[model samples]
Target: MPTPAGADAARRYPVDPNSRLNVRSGPGTNYQLVRVLPYGASVPVNCQKPGETITGTYGTTDLWDNIANGQYVSDAFVYTGSDGYIAVRCS
Candidate 1:
């Protein structure tokens, strides 16, 4: 379905600036690594859901952002600008 005209989509940003962002099959480290995003890589957050807390160079948080179908990354690894929910919750 198409988004309604002028409907706001969540803003996207380059989540990392220094380290390579690890893309995973799921939200936790236990999940398999699927890809490695280079520094300043584009990581568009589709939506967010609560998952495993990861302590990376950024900080610690259990929040996970869905980048694609079945693909998730810990919010701690990405700089979402806002510390709280900035997008719609995943259904």
Candidate 2:
């Protein structure tokens, strides 16, 4: 599907500059940790899901961003410029 106008390919969102966000196998901290995003990294949110709510640099939420297949990061650390879903909800 085409991305919304003014939003890049899925809209790359900035990770909290002070954080090295954890990439997980699933949408919550209970999931396996896959990796850590670099400081100042930005990520394209392919989709989203609601999971364990977390509080981070951006605020608090249960929203998790799927950055790749089987990879996710808490939306609380992503600067998506909104408090709601910015991409399609993951099936």
Candidate 3:
């Protein structure tokens, strides 16, 4: 089997201790809250995009399907405010 994109082999980014990380369905707050990621959670960020202003849509929509098996982060990457971050699976 081929190694998946943004798989466990990918480098994980540590959650900022000061930032209030919101776990959304998609890569925006418009998405539903799957869960709130606490500080220190190591999230796998496949690609980082520049900040862009867009209207909120579906809550917790599957956005990171291209990365893993789609089962991991159906709704992972999200844009919270001006900063962008990926949601990591908590152990």
Among all candidates shown, the one with the greatest TM-score:
2
Worst 10 residues of 1 by lDDT: 5-14
Considering TM-score, where higher is better, how would the candidates rank from best to worst?
Answer: 2, 1, 3
State the lDDT of candidate 3 residue by residue for 1-91, as single tens digits.
9978757547555544544455544544455666666755556554333222332322333343222232123232333222333434322
**Count of steric clashes across candidates, in order:** 0, 0, 9
lDDT, candidate 2, at 14? 90
lDDT head-to-head 1 vs 3, winner:
1
Q: lDDT of model 1 at residue 64?
A: 83
Displacement of residue 15 (Cα, Å) in model 1 is: 2.1
TM-score, per-candidate, Cα-based: 0.79, 0.89, 0.42
Q: Identify the runs in model 3 with alpha carbons over 4 angstroms from their true place.
A: 1-9, 47-91
Model 2 earns a TM-score of 0.89
lDDT of 3: 0.41
lDDT-better candidate, 1 vs 2: 2
lDDT of 1: 0.77
What is the lDDT of every predicted structure here? Answer: 0.77, 0.92, 0.41
| Over 4 Å off, model 1 | 1-10
